[model samples]
Target: MKTKKHTILKKSVLIIVTFLILLSLLGQTDLGNFSSQDNSEFNYVTIQKNTIRYLQKGQGKDILLIHGSPGSIEDWNKIIDSLSVDYRVTAFDRLGHGYSSDYEYSHHIEDNAILTNQIIKQFNLKSPLIVGHSYGGSTAAFMAVNDNNSDQKYIILDSPLYEIKMQPIYMTTTLPVLGKGFSLLFSYTISDMFIENGLNDILVSIDTNQRNTIIKQRQHIWSQPKVIFNKSMETKNYNSDLKQISNRYPNLKSHFTIVTTKDTLKTFRKDCEKFHKEIPNSSLIYLENTGHYIQIERPWAVLNIIRQKMEGQPSSYKKQ
Candidate 1:
């Protein structure tokens, strides 16, 4: 009787495992049609081996937008229309994200900065104002410090500028074969759900329409295994990159306008404050009742800040 009971228990466990495997496979099937067919309106440029996808509109001083981890050019959709009205707005899918060609995750911030510079040179953008969000902020800072172009100014939107505690989940993706397998499984099985939940948490003040568009764009990119791996590498290596930036912080020449939110994560806000203190010339602005997705929540406010900066206004913000 005991043997029979053990056999039954084993069978029950096998059945449960089989059911879960089937569920994961079914989820992949449901999301298999991941394509950027909706973004055909954008143009592409081949920078080296990577085919960088971008959208350019209006005509004025170049306003380059760089998105964060697991993001694409579409992240600027909410504010692009408004900003394009006054400036020549350009946004691109960073290599290994969106429709761009896949590349190995080098975990060095300078790699992205170099690619950004290449894009600027290829398009012959004359001292464009680069606006970088989240991880893109690091890229912008690198560009300012290294490119040494006197005309370049920057707006960092809710970026992680100081040291950060790496999450174990992110570290897992930096492993060898295990990382590739795990990234593939996550991307195929639950990337959309992860993207949706993350967006909901970060974009607390966004409207339904804007939220939906952001989610769609992020989901399309997050579903790709290469993009997922790249994000993992970025998170895992962020602390090292921050250390390098800290060493070169004083050398940053481009003027900066840093934007943050009242509702930002405690650690992230602390980093922002540290960044502000280190860079005395940089201006820091706080938006009340906002989260990490400040660009989407308060596009008009961002536009005003940009306009003020362009008009040569003095830097002002309450010191924390």
Candidate 2:
């Protein structure tokens, strides 16, 4: 009877080991073929212990672009050319994303803000305009609050400035041991599913070339465990970060131009309105029938608003 029990236990262990090995092999094949064709074009800047990857184009007043969660500098690919024509456009892959070194275990918004300020200082950017999208918007706001003495303007595009409810997958990835295991086993697979499912229904309106670029960028980042882990941490602690930002909201010195659409998450729209009400020297623009990816969906609207604000035009999008 003892021999029989031992035999059953050994068989079970063998089956589990076999399953893990197969899963690892599957993950390798499916996640390892990311194309590195566009990597050569990026420039690197060493910030503290990590190297940041960035792209710079054109020459004029500086405009820094910060991308959202699970994103890289390529998020601005569609509008960079046009924006760079009039401004020294610089877009960077935030830590752990794209070509940036994934040395950090946590990617809290405030840390990202500090990194951004470092970039601005390193480049000696003078009175630069910072444009942040989604999660990037949160970082921009935090940077503005902390670096009040810096002459900076901000344009927040469909950002979750106030609060965000964590998604199930993000929550699952925040677990200690289980999180790493899940990321290793399923991050690329989940990313593939998102791509197959049209990537949140926002990519349908984007141009094919731009959409492909964004997908390639996502593929590269999703395959990296550090990036995935950091993203999960961001989601897990997002609310606390917002609360910290809220305390400093009254002291922010930068002017802001907020562009948002009603079709986005309800919490995001509410937060944008709250931000406009609480933060001084800020204006909000509401776009009808648009998606959250306003940068790609309606680049002209964003550029026009930014140009008008920078050129001292009257703020036209004030809430009644």
Candidate 3:
């Protein structure tokens, strides 16, 4: 009876493993043909063997906008028009996000930062003010630390500056071969539904119509299996990158304007405060009632801050 039970257990395990391998194989079949209908005017530039989609408008001192994870250049649509009116505003689809070409390397924040610097150089942007939101904030921070231009100004919006614990899904996708398999599986199975549900929470200040539009756009890029794996890698590398930045915070030379909403995660708010206190030339702003997507919810606030930075306004803490 014992031998029979052992044989049955071995068969069960083999069947389960076979089923998972088959599911992962199904997940590997690329189903995403992601497209952005609003990108008719967008242009592409190849760097490091990866093609990046970008948009530039208006003319003045340059302003580079770095968007969040699982986001595209369209994430800045609400403020792009206003900012582009006076400033040479530039935004792009980061590698593995939006329509940009995917790479097998880990999408670390530092890599994005290096890419951002390359964009600055490639586009001939002259000491432009950098505005980064969410994951983009980390990229901006890394750029500011590495670049020698002390006069460069940065506006960070609701970014994770400290080493906060990642979600279980993000953790699960960091495994070796299992990570890729899990990312593929998740992308094929529930990534769209997850993104749809998540939009409601992040885009709280937007109306139903606007929120629906964003949800559709996000669903397009995030449904790609490569994009899913890219995000997982970024999240996995976030903590180590921040740890490196933390050591160099005191020596940071660029002026920083950190903005956060009243309804931000407690961990984010705490980190924001800690980041503000540590950096010598950093200023913090708090906006009431706005959720995570402050740029979408309060474009004017971001615009006003950009204008202030352009005008050489002194950094000071304020509430909006």
Error of 2 at 136 (Å): 0.7
Tens-digit lDDT track for model 3 on 97-190?
Answer: 8888765555788789878988999999998888999899888888877874678899998888878677788877777666667777777689
| lDDT scores of the candidates, listed in order | 0.75, 0.74, 0.81
Candidate 2 lDDT over residue span 150-246, tens digit each: 3567889888877888778877666755565556665646756654344556653666786677666667566665556667788898899888887
Please tell me which predicted candidate would have the highest lDDT against the true structure: 3
For each candidate, give its TM-score against the true structure: 0.83, 0.84, 0.89
lDDT of 1: 0.75
Candidates, ranked, TM-score = 3, 2, 1
List model 1 lDDT by residue over 1-320, tens digit each: 99999999999999988865664454333233233445568888887777778888888878888998767876777788888788888889887787776545375778789888888888888778889988899788777767655556788988888776776777666775456555676887777897888778777776799779878877876778767777888888888887776777766666788888877553267667777777646878888777787777777787777666655776444322
Using TM-score as the yardstick, the better of models 1 and 3 is: 3
Clashing residue pairs, backbone N/CA/C < 3 A, model 3: none
Candidate with top TM-score is: 3
